[model samples]
Target chain A: MQVRKIMCACGSGLGSSLMVEMNIQDVLKKMGVEGVEVVHSTTSDVHPGAADLFVVGRDLADFIKDVDKDEIIVLQNIVDKGELEEKLRAKLEA
Target chain B: MAGMAEMLKRENVQIVEGVDSWEESVRVAVQPLVDQGYVEARYIDGIISNAKEFGPYFVICPDLALLHARPDQGVLKRQLAVTVLRRPVRFKEEGPDVRVLVTLAATDADGHIEVMRRLATMFCDPDNITKIAEANTADEVYAFFTAPIE
Candidate 1:
């Protein structure tokens, strides 16, 4: 997988998911990792093969394990750019 | 992007010293918006239910939680309510302890995108969180996000 598409998710899909999406985009841009598309989603809307990567909270990590496909990343603070930068670095590099 | 000061109104911003629980905090924080007819009664129910099902997904940072419900659930408008609690409220035992709750309602998927974008940037600043926590009045809270978006 090329990891071209990323989907961020929270409980309701409206608030925090979008927050994560924007932060992820920021990291990708700062890292100069281009051509990657990031989107927002909810726990119920996620499934296997929907995207190259899935970003979610650790609490909801189990529910999406079936679809994680070895690319489900969990974060303590979704809006913290430092943490996001560190985590996304490994994936974007991989 | 719309900053938090503009996204939230003075009437909707609250400074409560104490709250019973995290769940109650969300309910109480969103009360103003509910009273103002910006959100429906079930919007509260939806936010609580979603939190229960998925844990505290909105605990975006160490001291903040952005409360929300799905647009299809019961949202009638794009509005935000800020409630600052003197004591920290923990949505889940393992989740980040939050001192402020910003209840939000969006009429459509993209209605609140700009506000959320601005908030994501705000959440990146650790210093801003401290300033927000020290704010004593709703107007003070409104002033915290008045700066132009970066």
Candidate 2:
């Protein structure tokens, strides 16, 4: 909600992030949220102000927890609809 | 981009439950692709190696693990294989027990985006995953992917 772009990341950037991106896109669509771009990236590709939100797996989230907690969305299960939707809803409603 | 339903053909699926360890699970998951020349033997090594290095970050959910490495490591093509164990295996100490293994081989960074999307759609739902976990045939499980997303 803060930025139009949401970055989905993993270790190598290309693999699992694609899957998480897909889930995020689907959830955002169902939420009627539009114009938000989901960027698939790796840890190396992420930096300050690189994205509006950083969505990553729990392991990688531990590394990024120091970043803006508001922008960092850590997922225990990348594909869980409830988890993804709830986090996005909280951030957007805030 | 081949959707997951297309990439994960009936031939590429294995339902041999109760694999001894996570290592054996990955080896069984990707062996079909290796035999068909879709991926190199080292692709298996790449998955296991990455899991060791990253501590099963591939364990995407409570019962699922999607394993992969740099496509340049050993991928011969953009493809994937799925293996559902009879019971979950501990991938890491105190981590999630994984029963489903998805070994991914992409030709390049973006090569498998659509396929991954389909998988994300299929596995995202707990109900769908429950159906898949109980499915006895690849077609039965794959039906979940081909079904129109609601």
Query: Which one wins on DockQ?
Result: 1
lDDT of 1 by residue, B1-150 (tens): 444555678788778888878878878988998898888888888889988887777777788888888888777767888888888888877756778788888776566787877777777887888788779787888766556665
For candidate 2, give the docking quality class from DockQ. Answer: medium
lDDT of 2 by residue, B109-147 (tens): 776777777677677676766776778887776565566
Each candidate's interface RMSD, rounded to one decimal? 1.2, 1.3
**Which tens-of-lDDT digit does each residue in A1-94 have in candidate 1?**
4788998887877778888898888788888889998999887878887788898877677778578556878887777778878888877677
The residue ranges of model 2 lying beyond 4 angstroms of the native Cα positions read B137-150
Instruction: Supply the TM-score for candidate 2.
Output: 0.87
In the order shown, the chain A TM-scores of the predictions are 0.91, 0.91
lDDT of 2 at B14: 71
Tell me the TM-score of model 1: 0.93
Indicate which candidate wins on lDDT: 1
Any residue pairs clashing in model 2, and if so which?
B17-B86
Candidate 2 lDDT: 0.78
